[model samples]
Target: MNIKSILAKPFAKTVVAKIYRQSNNAVKVQQNLMQKLLSQAAHTAFGKDHNFSEIKSYEDFKKEVPICDYEALKPYVERVVNGEKDVLWKGQPLYFAKTSGTTSGIKYIPLTKESMPTHISGAKNALLHYIDETQNADFLGGKMIFLQGSPELGDTNGIKTGRLSGISAHYVPKYLMKNRLPSWETNCIEDWETKVEAVIDETIHENMTLIGGIPSWVQMYFERIVERTGKKVGEVFPNFNLFVYGGVNYEPYRNKFEDLIGRKVDAIELYPASEGFISYQDSQDENGMLLLVNNGIFYEFIPSEEFFDENPTRISIANVEVGVNYVIILNTNAGLWGYNIGDTVEFVSLNPPRIVVTGRIKHFISAFGEHVIGKEVERAINSQTENTSISINEFTVAPQITPVAGLPYHEWFIEFENEPEDLMVFAQKIDESLQQQNTYYFDLISGKVLQPLKITVIEKGGFNNYMKSVGKLGGQNKVPRLSNDRKIADELSKFQQK
Candidate 1:
């Protein structure tokens, strides 16, 4: 056995054991974690204000602290950004992860010394768990390229600020630095196009075994490598075996990636946010990702159907049922209490609770009251594509509310690497598939309340160009897949017209 494999054996075994133990006692583990977080922050201003001392259990805590979004906690976050110590967490945060806001301009999320480990440790344990399950520690024997944002951090008051990936880049372990690709100079390039070229130039000939990044950006790298080397990904990196990805759905890009690599490879999905690393794919035998119960973040679930209600019921891990979509609420050691990160997930397993990211709370199509979500749209596309020979690159759906003289309809903007031979038939298949998945959507179409879905084949690179124009081309930035309004659709229309 290789040295890397030998060294990993103990760590991997421990991680697998912890996962198994925690899964069996998930409710108890979550309860203990929740108490620990609350007690840790009890002396802080937020804690005092929320009467954390008086809170003894999940019920007491929920009643004491109100569920909040970024806007609701913006004031406390601003205080932290302005050099206030112990305003949220116990001390000044080590850094602020600046995330793009949906309604607001920019959100500065605090990352403390206590919370940083949740991100790093969760990631390390994810790979360790994978290694344990597959007994494939040989991946540790080869280089792994992490396509991350620039490591050059900007300052917000006294605290450092940058994208989460950029912040994480600074913390790459010293041992792995030798195997990590792309010099610091290359990561700091800022412009994705330039950085991608730099990455391709630096690692085209390296003995790479793993590639980790968002699917779209990594696909961009693969496309460039293919164009430059005139070889499939397998030929360029003979040892490449694992693809680790998150931040967006991987279904649409799966076929395209397999084609580029010239064969199928193992993939691991992660559910990480600027807030924390929530979950990761542990067992290939399981369909859903295992929840990080022992992580520093404490979790609660509010059913998606009741999310907009004035006072929705919040259920703890003990009460969460399988197959119900829930908006996740968090109370973290970073000093966030009852914060809603706007993402939605559905529990697929209850024993060792596992979840699937269903969609964003704000990212849905319900303009005409037929509430279609990201999962539905992705499922429709995947189902239809499976029956055809075409490959999808990227796609987004938005309701076209304004029609010259007909019923309103949903408009799809798609970028295809291989265009379908029968575009009209492909569009019809998608419409039919969507109808089958969502009863409300089917009713809208069947009753002639809404027109059939319209497909617009965007020129190749249109989505990338649009993202670049808007300064969100890479590093956890993704094109919103479904929207009730035409903001993204109209913007994409301009690109299509060109």
Candidate 2:
């Protein structure tokens, strides 16, 4: 380990702003500060600019601001895309982070220069803190392969844009700029398709030592590298000091990653957005991720029950409990005030509140007259399908509305590793498992309120092509296990003819 990396831990990545800690004493102090800031932002965002008051209480702030999901504020997003400065943010948005919502069409999220520092600084702090916790400062010196979205930048007319990840081209640690994946002049596709080859080649030949990215896409790259090099992940890149992944839960993909690598790869969780990186896994080997302080925001959590199947919770941060899943409500320097990021999370503890991202609220489905949340579906699938050697690569469940029959049943499109003969039996097991967690689904199924659940086994790369055809990137963002409905099932089945 180098001396500079040792000294850099606490000092190098200093947090740029002060955030409210989750303590009553601190809450009291922050409540006063939050009101003043929120009031001030209102004036600034709405043209009064200077006459603003400090936030006095969480309740008061909540009453003043309405909940905002991306759908509710599409006009504001359009303003940012059209470069409308005053309506969206004080400054013109430099880029739009294209985030896909289940019901609310594709979101062209806004990001400004002033607002941009939150994610950048937070990510840096996360890396520094990871090094500090793992006591592996030397890990910082290795090449990092960000298994991110395709690199193709913007459409010629600027109407279409790349993944939120493509923005990493503009901001990364200036020092590690050379070691990072994307080049200054190259587009995102080149970064992924073209530059990725160099990263793979270097990992094999130059002793590359670090890997970071979303697990699925990262796994894809690993598969490609393995296919090309004829060497396993660990043997080809033995010096890999760490692997960082985020954007989605690592539970389902973790063991597969280990199996391929032939070793336990050190990993850190990254919670990033086109707008910002809110929290990073601070402590090494810890189960939870800490909220980065001074990361330019006041955050809130609307209780899970408040939004289990409602309009959505835009609750206050102070009112949040220790072990509840709540949708993230954020007030940040990025000109976003009382904004709902749409991500659902649960607190592991309240003392400085360590949170685990539960899932997205938008990704829930209610097909068989029973609302099945993403996590519930995931839990059922993980448990019921554990014994099967055939792996489900991508899948979605939709309501099969038969005009002849009034009942609408769940139709599943599953991409499997190996085709199983008893597909109906597999569906029954999963149905049974789902029934255990959600009584409503079981009741509906048993009463024949919905038709018998149908499963259509898809070709291996069916969903992958479907997403590519839709212009969605092929990582965590695509085909989340459970979705609102299976609109893409037809597109998924297109691979059978291929």
Candidate 3:
């Protein structure tokens, strides 16, 4: 073993052990974190406004602070944007993670000095956990690539601002600098296609051992490598054994990914957002990621089914139950209190608070009173494709309420890498799986209120073309897995197979 690998083993073990111990007392750790956050921010504008000084317990907190999406919190965020110190948190934010929002044109999420370390440490510990379990620190000895946004920062009201991934680029540990690939110059290229080409040119022949990115973007990179060298990714980088990914479910893309790599490789899932790094996979044998309870954030959950109801039941980690989908809320050291980041999750293990991200609160199809979430559709597609030759490049679902003919149905736009022999049979299988998982959907189909879901073949590069048309071609942007309306489906119609 090389020097880095040798050193990494001990460090990895230490971190993993620390995480295990902290997770064992998850509720207490979160309660303590909540107190710390309230006490530290008590004098701030938001804290004072919410009577943070009088809030002695979680119940008091819930009664004092109302849940806030970006619009609800915009007034305070505006003050922070105009360079107000102690407006939200204790002092001026270190950086603003600029992200595109649906209703709000551009969102500026603060990254305070206290909360920034959690983002870096969360990713670091995920790998360390893998190393501790598998004794596979050998990857640390070879080149690593994280396909991310440009590290370029732009000023927003005198605060350094960039995409969350770009901000994270500035914090890559010194130890990994030697092994990190795609030279700094290549990473700074703004155009994703250009950046990918440059990244290929820079690291195509290097001893790359790990690759990380959103599944769709990484698929493009893998295809580029194969096109350029007429070799599978595994052949190009024999040591590349780990793929770290986030932002979307990886199961639907697994068959295509393994096909491109030419073998099965280990992967780590991360639940991160501009707001905070909430969880990371801690074990290869586990079903979900370990929640960061002791991190500088306190969490709340509103049952997903009741999320739209008036006065939803919001509970702490201590009250969460396994298998129940809940919309996650955050109160972070960054000064975001009772913040709704929109992601929904389900606890797989409540003892140590391991969670699987189910879907986004807004990213679902309930057009026919049958709520089909991202997780359900992803599960349905994967259920059909597993152990089969069928592999898809990418897909999205939308409600076809008023079709040219026949009853209303869910339309699935799919870009197939390897199409199944019988398209109708494949669609039937996926539809059946989806129905089984969602009782409402099953009832609707049985009642003749909706027809079976239809699959529309999207020609190669269709999704990318659609993303490009909207100026979100790459870097941290992903197509929502499902939509209630036909906005995306209408745009994708031109690319559909004849």
Q: Whose lDDT is greatest here?
A: 3
Q: Give the per-residue lDDT digits (tens) of candidate 1, residues 88-108.
A: 879899989988786767999
Worst 10 residues of 2 by lDDT: 15-24
Provide the overall lDDT of each model, using Cα atoms, as 2-decimal numbers: 0.89, 0.64, 0.93
Compared with the true structure, what per-residue lDDT tens digits does model 3 show for residues 68-122?
8998999999999999999899889999999989999899999999999999999
Error of 2 at 151 (Å): 7.4
Tens digits of per-residue lDDT for model 2, 348-368: 766565688877776666755
Highest TM-score model number: 3
Distance from true location, Cα of 18 in model 2, Å = 10
Models sorted by lDDT, best on top: 3, 1, 2
Candidate number with the higher lDDT (1 or 3): 3
Model 2: how far residue 146 lies from native, Å: 1.2
Report the error of model 2 at residue 268, Å: 1.8
Candidate 1 stretches with Cα past 4 Å from truth are none
Number of backbone collisions per candidate: 0, 11, 0
